[model samples]
Target: MKIKIIKIVLFTLIFIIMLSCITKILQPKDDGAIYGVRTFFAQNNNHNSDILFIGSSHIHCSINPAILYKEYGISSFNLSSGSASFWSIYFYIKESMKYIKPRLIVVDMYTINQGAPYPPDFIFKRFAISMPLSLNKINAIRMEASKNVFHYYINPLVFYHERYSELNFIDFLLYKGRKNRYKYYKHYIPSVKVHLQNEPNIKSIYDVSKLYYKVEEYYLRIIKISKINDIPILFIVAPYVLSNEEQRRFNEAERIANEYNVPFINFNLNYGDYNLDFSKDFRDAGHLNDEGAAKFTRYLGKYLKENYDLPDRRGDPKYYSWEMNAKYHDKDIYNIELKQYTNLNEYMEKVKNADDYVIGITMLGNYQKNDRVLQSIATNFNIDNIYLKNASYVVDNNKLIYSSDGSNQYLFHKEIGSYTDLVIQNGQRLSINRRNYIKTKNGINIVIYDKFTEEIVDNIYLQKY
Candidate 1:
């Protein structure tokens, strides 16, 4: 009887271990926003931020921590889950406090109208998968997940087991551990697409309906936690293409904020102060693109610096990681800006405006020296003439680094970072690490490199019809 009991226990342990391994392999990777940001915050000592930005996608799309640190020397993080309701935000705030002690908490009020007792299943899945086994998470599962779906959130394998058939090598790799993808952006993702739409003329309606009971309850709970922790909380409404109904809801939120004596700012009504151009700033009706995010972040950074007692850790050795992350952010912004232009003329014009680009312009075969576009580039670069023969020009920033019109004698080589080299031959052939990038040799070949990242951004071949 004793031997049989021991055999049963050993077999059970082996089965449990195998099951754990299978469950991990089938689990999805944590996107930097939902679970990854919280993991990053807990792991990195430098991520003990001065301010915490929390809410829905609006906060993630608008509030950029790198920009805040770069422009104002203020350390911050965006701990936003996409489409998270107030209940989720409350739990997120609870989870975040275990990692970092923040001075101020900025809450986005965009999700105030979400009246559901629980978030959508997809969003709930993200929350459950991201949270570890804790009393807080258990309570969240209990209250937020219904009895029918509770098992699914707790043991995700119940639902995700089918994913095993769809798994690739990435799934096996992630089963071990995942890296912090949002390290550079600090949990911010920038959208580059430009969306042009007329702003809705939403008149303030003071007599709008009251806030949802659950929303108000969770919101107050957040405020209570902030007060208990001695952290100041600021409420904000991020600017978006608003509707009359949304504006009315925001009006109701403002009244609540006033009652709580919390500072509230609705950016939709004060777009003029931020110099927001609706045509170029928005990626969609609801979110700001990179350009718009820059403007909004700059304004907020200045406001925080002036109003709050935040430290400026710009040149300090302790916060050197922030400086490096800022450079990475700048590189991403430059890359996005370069990718937006397809026309050679417009692309050259943008490069001319930015001072941190290494530009290579080559003309191959027979080309018109008097071409208007060539003349415009020559005028901007202050060149005396445009070459009619095969010619190559390398401009570092706005300064002429190297220029050669010879077809055979022109050979330029520069090591990029550690592994790659920028090589040019005879004004026509352009290669990075001997990999051909020029689309055509018959016309003009141009390559642009970002000075901050030391990486090639774009290669363009333009021909006149």
Candidate 2:
């Protein structure tokens, strides 16, 4: 009987080890805002912070903590993920307090409008995968997860077992517990996408008639907790394309804030205050892209420094992580700016008035389509296929005219073109690189100009293959 017991124990231990190995080798990739929150908890250590911001994906990209630290000396952390609901946030704040002591809590009041039991399946999955196991999570399951509480808590693999087939290097990374640095806007996601024009103007369709009972319940708990701890809590609605119906719901949020005496700032109504251009600022209708985030952070940092008593942790060796994170964060911003040169018109606009950048107006592609010479490059050279087509270019007040197949003969889909007569207007005077062309000939012209001297610093012509 003792021998049989030992065999059973040995099999149990083997099964547990196999389970851990399998789970590690076959997990899905993480994305969206949950990736940031997961990294913070798994690898980062933030025992003390001057401010803590929490909320949905909107806050994840809207508020940048690195900028706050760089400009205002604010020491902060973001404990949020995409689609974080009221009860979940309440629990998150509670869990975070175990390690961090923050002076203020900033909650973005966007998801509060959804109010209720279980959210949509996708958003719920964000919580299921990102949230760690604890009593608060169990309570979260009980209150919101309802019947699937056991499956969510005790047996996550039961739902995700099929992931075994989709294993890859990312799965290994997941097993190794790799994480991203906080250089990414603290918890705020930077935006690289720019939606300039042609966006539809959407108005609100529904008014939030009443708050979800659970939402009100959890929101009240937040207020009560803040009061007990004597910690200042601020509720804010980040800037987005808000509709009138949505405005009404947030108005309801404001009413509740007033009832609790918590300050609520709706940034959507204060776009001009932040000088945020909706077309250029938003990554999507819901989130601020990188450029907008920097602007908002600069504004918010200055405002916080002036209005709040948050300490500046810059130059303090104890907060060296913040300084290091700031460097990486700016590096990401520089990378984002690099993407703007992809479109030809955007590239020109960026260097339109600038002088320090290197502008290369060269023929891109095989030069099959007769196209105009590139106008200018600011920071780096922009080689776009769009500019390497049957197009005409007139630069330096017609000092140089690059015509492909001639304007009188317009080919519908002709794909043969070249860069001819590259007129480079650097600082002053048009330096035209006139290429010797035979009939149906193609080559590239380059003009390097100094902006300050207004002089043709250098020029060249080349063959495009």
Candidate 3:
């Protein structure tokens, strides 16, 4: 009887181990907003985060923790899930309490106008997956799921098991080598795409109206939770082109804030304070691009510092992660700005001094002898004979790694990150990981590949006439 009982226990342990491994392998690995937030939050052991930003996409895209730390030394985290309704956010706050003890909670009011009682399955599922297994998670799933709560979300494998076929080699490896990829992300994922918008002119309606009943209930619950924990909470409506209807809803949000004595700020009405340019700051009417987010975050950081009792964690060894995170965030900004340069001389100047990038250059067709800017760039790459029919060069960390002089047909291959192939035939052809980056047919073509991001930053051409 003793031997049989021991066998049963051993069998159960083996089965559980195997199940956990399969579940991890089957789960989708690339949802940054979902997985990144949960993983980073779990990793924050210092519990030094003084503020927490929660809400929909607005919170994640608009509030940059890196900039907050860099500018004001305010320790914070964007513990937000995209498209998450207040129902999920309430539980997110509850789950987060298990880890960090924050002094303030900032709620993004963008989803307050959403009329749905529960968020859509796609949004709910991501939020649910982002939460760790606990009593809070179980309760959240039960309330959020219409039915079959135990079957669908109790174990994510039911939904993700089919992804067994999608599993790649990286999935089996622990960490999946993504440690450095999002190190600077800090749960703040800003959109790099830009969309110009005409400045919106909308006035808040004076008539007081109530929020959607379910939204009001959850919002009140969030306020009550903060009060119970003795943590202050702030509500913000991040800047976006607003319509009359949306402004009315936001006005309702303000009324709630007033009633509860919670601090609230509507950025749509106060865009000028941040010098927000409608044409340049937004990725869309609904979201801010990187530039806009940085501006908004800087303003918000200053406000938090002046108005709140948040500490400056900069230069503190205990908050070294925040400093490192800011560095990585700056690298992301550098990558974005590098692609916007059109002047070859200015572009090369920035490139030549930066040792972190792997640079590739190929000269095609008759060199523009009269164009001094083009000639200067060629000389920088050690193209001694600009009069030569063709030349190709590769620079790693500002050192000449490879060069092909006077060769019309030169095939140069190197592993910048993964691999890069530069072939100068009739015209210069450059590709990174098989993605062609030939911007112009004939000119001095240069490609910048960032070693840190392991991706091509930009491709420029000094067109020769």
Q: What is the lDDT of residue 276 in candidate 1?
A: 94
Residue lDDT tens for model 3, 77-191 = 7877778887888888888887877888899988887886667777887876677778888888777887755578777668686776787766775445445555434677666
Off by over 4 Å in 1: 1-25, 29-39, 172-185, 343-465
Task: Tell me each candidate's TM-score.
Answer: 0.72, 0.68, 0.83
The RMSD of every model to the true structure, in order and in angstroms, is 6.7, 12.6, 4.0
In model 2, where do residues sit more than 4 Å from their true spots?
1-21, 174-185, 197-208, 342-465
Cα TM-score of candidate 3 = 0.83
lDDT of 1 by residue, 1-465 (tens): 999999999999998898777866776765544544454444465345788898888988898888898779998777787777788888878878887778899999999988778777887777776666677888888878899987877775686866878886556753122232234336677889898979777654456667889898888898889889988999998888877887887888888788888888888887889999998999999899988999999998888899999999889877766776686777678777777776767777777877667777787767576687678668766566567767777777787766785556778887643344677777656776577667766777878776555567788777755
Every candidate's lDDT:
0.76, 0.62, 0.76
TM-score of 2: 0.68
Per candidate, the number of residue pairs that clash is 0, 17, 0
Q: Which has the higher TM-score value, candidate number 2 or candidate number 3? A: 3
Name the Cα RMSD for model 1. 6.7
List the candidate 3 regions with Cα displacement exceeding 4 Å. Answer: 1-22, 29-32, 161-176, 198-204, 360-377, 382-392, 404-447, 459-465
